[model samples]
Target chain A: MSRSTRIMMSVIYWAFVVYVFVPLILMIMMGFKDSKFIGFPIKSWTFDWYLAVFSDTEVLTVFGYSTAIALLSTVVSLFVGTWIAVLLADRKFFGRAVMFGLMVLPALVPGIISAIAFRIYARVLGIEPGMFAIIWSHAVHNVPFVCLVVMARLSTLPKSQREAAQDLGADPLVTFVRITLPYLRPALIGASVFCMLLSFDDFVRSFFLGGYQPTLPVLIFAKLRSGMSPEINAISTVVLILTAFLGIWAERSMRRMKKET
Target chain B: MTSDAPTQGAAAGTAAAAGPRSLWSSLARSQPYQKFVDVLFASQRRSFLILLLPPIIWVLSQHLGPIVQMVSVSFTDAYPRPPGQEAKFTFDNYLLFFREPVYMMPFMRTLIYAVVLTFTTLIIVYPVAYFLARHVKRENRMALLLLLLIPFWVGEIVRTFAIMILLGNTGAVNLILKSLGLIDRPIPFMYTGFSVSVGIIYLTALYMLMPLYSALEKIPASYTEAAADLGAGAWTRFRRVTLPLTYEGIGSGATLVFLISTGYYGTPVLLGGPNTTVFAETIAGFFHVAGDKWPTGAAFACIMFLASLALTGAFLSGMNRLSKGGRK
Candidate 1:
């Protein structure tokens, strides 16, 4: 590459990076501003808003509620997704193509469309809008990701391992528990964290289905509607720190596990 | 089967003589339980069914079932009909969309915005993806990509709030411009089409970047080097070789960005003015009102869904044809 072209590319790359981080940095900065308003030229700073996030009962409850829902949905999706992946991993199967399409259809549908559909379906089933309804929608939404991830991991498994287990008189269930499950540990952990983050960050579904209590994103939406506040920024900063940490951890561990195997 | 019956009878007799130590333990050790376990794994077909049944039921009931229900609701006269009323079928719900310019305009605007924004995101993100995948050292690429992705991990509402902070009257943009003497007064950037577009591009750019980066990364260095040896200019080399090779990535990235942009409810609501209302807000407006209008919302949602799917299908096929032609 020419020197001028290389310089141009580097400049563009750094500009994009600045564009990505400027808003985020401003958000974090606004969180520490002492005044009620959100703006530049902060004459004072304080930690009161960040402290308020922990001391406020309502915010704390919403955090616990969102975490509970994320955990429940993640566990359910992992179970269903792993089952489907195992079934589809066979070399030749009838209707495999059709089944795979069906598996992926949910993830392709837009969030609003699916959320509306689930709202209607929940009413039809006499399931009132509440925690159960939210969990059901989140798990269904997350299953495809889990299935895809687990299936990718399963594809790399050596066939002879299973055959060897069978040669030693292990039953199908035993062999699966001892051999297949162990092999899928890294993928399962990765998919679980991904699902948790997805479910926790989900807004449309939770907003549509939630009743009296709101999840974290829905609560943030409510706060936004009232108007922007330093408290909202503090809450956002905390969430950003948390999810970034979890995501980085998952990526590093998955890469390390892949190398080990 | 016949032999198992006698064994089961003996086990029951033995349990009776054991003074009822524990009914659960006795039953677990019984012949019938063993037989059931044996039958489950007796054939590969049986095991396959055991694995396949749950996902099939789940997909049918949870995934496809709700969508099918939505379609049915869209055709109905009313939903949540008062206690005992039957659901009468009608096309009026869908007809409402075609007749009202208020509804139709936003729907059209949504399609246009989605296409334009998807293209814009592709243009803005392509060079950066190229830089990372082709120019940067492979060892540093992953760390840089992760840094870029951290902002996306936060929820939509939080990120939208960030945009609101950046564009408000007293926001960073206005403050900086004022300080620099570029303007004496703050510019109103919030609640505009520009704001909404910027927010959507910010949110959906990652979708485009991932696919394009992977596609660019997969291109062999030899092809570009060979083109260089043949004395092709930089622009010609890119147009003929790199762009054609990344068509699959472009197609996928465009599809994801388009679909996501079309379905956005929160960002548009937060950043857009009344004039810039998108189709998702229009559909959501119906659900926010009386229950009687929910059918109308379902119908509108279905229209958006089918239209987006059709456009993407066409775009993908066009990309496929172009890629094939380029190869020839």
Candidate 2:
């Protein structure tokens, strides 16, 4: 890079950094404003909105619901996803391409269409819509992603490892527990984190699944619907920080895996 | 056309060698030291099926079903019927949409909006993505990438509404400008196409950055280094080497942005003025608010679904084609 080009890139980069941070800074500033609607440009600061945001049961529960659903979806999807990867790796199966396509289907579909299908599907099954169904939908949506990432790891595993384990008197169960699971730890964790973040950050799937209860993103969407308010800003501030931390965690894990390979 | 298929022959070979016991029994076995090998192989197939069935079923119904239904809806009169007519399927909806000024104009508007948003986001995200990919040190690289993507992790509604606050008439933007005597009254920033585009850009720009950044990062340092060693200019190397290498990322990013922006609702609804009706909002209006005419909304949705499917296919095949990374 030449000095002039380097200077130009640096200037543009800093400007972009400003573009990224300023809205958020304004959001935080607006959060402390003594106002109900997000009017922007603070006259004076107050923590009343923050208090209202935390103290309001309805607002707080949405956050709680999203967190719970995200966690459960992550764990359940990880298990199912891992199982699929194991099967995919160890077996040659009929209609594998079809299965892989089906697995990634939900993501490829538009949200509005998916929402209607869920609405109908839940009705025909006579299953009530709520947290359980919401979690199920999220898990189903994310598992294929988990499978794809983990399958990358699974394919690279030397056949010798499994064969060696079996020859040394280790049963399939023992070999999987002792060798496969440990070896797959990084990809598994990567898949898990990615799935969790996805579940939490999602809006569309949750909208369909949410009936009596609203997930965090849906709740935020609802709030955005009527009008913009300062309370939403405070909420975004917290989310931005948490997700940033999670992204860092993912980046490190990926780098570590790359080095090992 | 799709992913690599699993072959049954592989299963047969593994099964013949692994031996057999019940997969469930392997789980319940007291001694996990090495004994339960046969059972693990026995249930692996079934467990994998069980694992994938729920989500696939969900997608088929939730995804594929709606698309089919939506296309069907596009044909019906939906709510207002012709004299002596019943709720029947016809090409009228498509014809009406194309012919009627009200619906036809908005569709064009929506298309322009999508195209503009795509190019604008691409232009804006490129340098930031570039810096993260090539210029940032490895140790600091991850941190910078996180910095770019962190806004997205917060969730779209929150981020969109945050912009609403900042750009609101009495919002911080005006407040700051006023405090600094840069303006006399709050600017009419909210509920306009500008505000809507800004919000959409913020929400979807992250999609562009991450993929482009991933592509950029994958370019070996040696390519540029060797170019520099040969006295090639920075711009020359970037145009010749870096850009070509990241075509997959570019394709994916553009596809993602295009798909996401087309289906967009939140930003446009919150920030778009009365004249700012998007195709998505029209779909929402057709079903939810427009007399419960599920069919018409379904039709509009089907168009979107079809467009996205085509776009996604184009993107993937393009990625596959460019997978050689311009080496050839």
The best candidate by TM-score is 1
Candidate 1 lDDT tens digits, A76-171: 999999998998886467788988988988888888898899999999999999999999999999999999989988988999999999898666
Chain A of candidate 2 gets a TM-score of 0.87
- The residue-by-residue lDDT of candidate 2 on A215-258, one tens digit each, is 87787788777666777777766676777688668757966786
The residue pairs that clash in candidate 1, if any, are: none
Clash statistics: count for each candidate: 0, 12
Global lDDT scores for all candidate models: 0.90, 0.72
Q: What range of 10 consecutive residues in model 2 chain A has the weakest lDDT sum?
A: A116-125
Overall local distance difference test of candidate 1? 0.90
DockQ of each: 0.63, 0.42
Candidate 1 stretches greater than 4 Å from native: A257-261, B1-36
**TM-score for each candidate, following the candidate numbering:** 0.93, 0.81
Predicted structure 2: lDDT: 0.72
**Model 1 TM-score (B-chain only):** 0.89
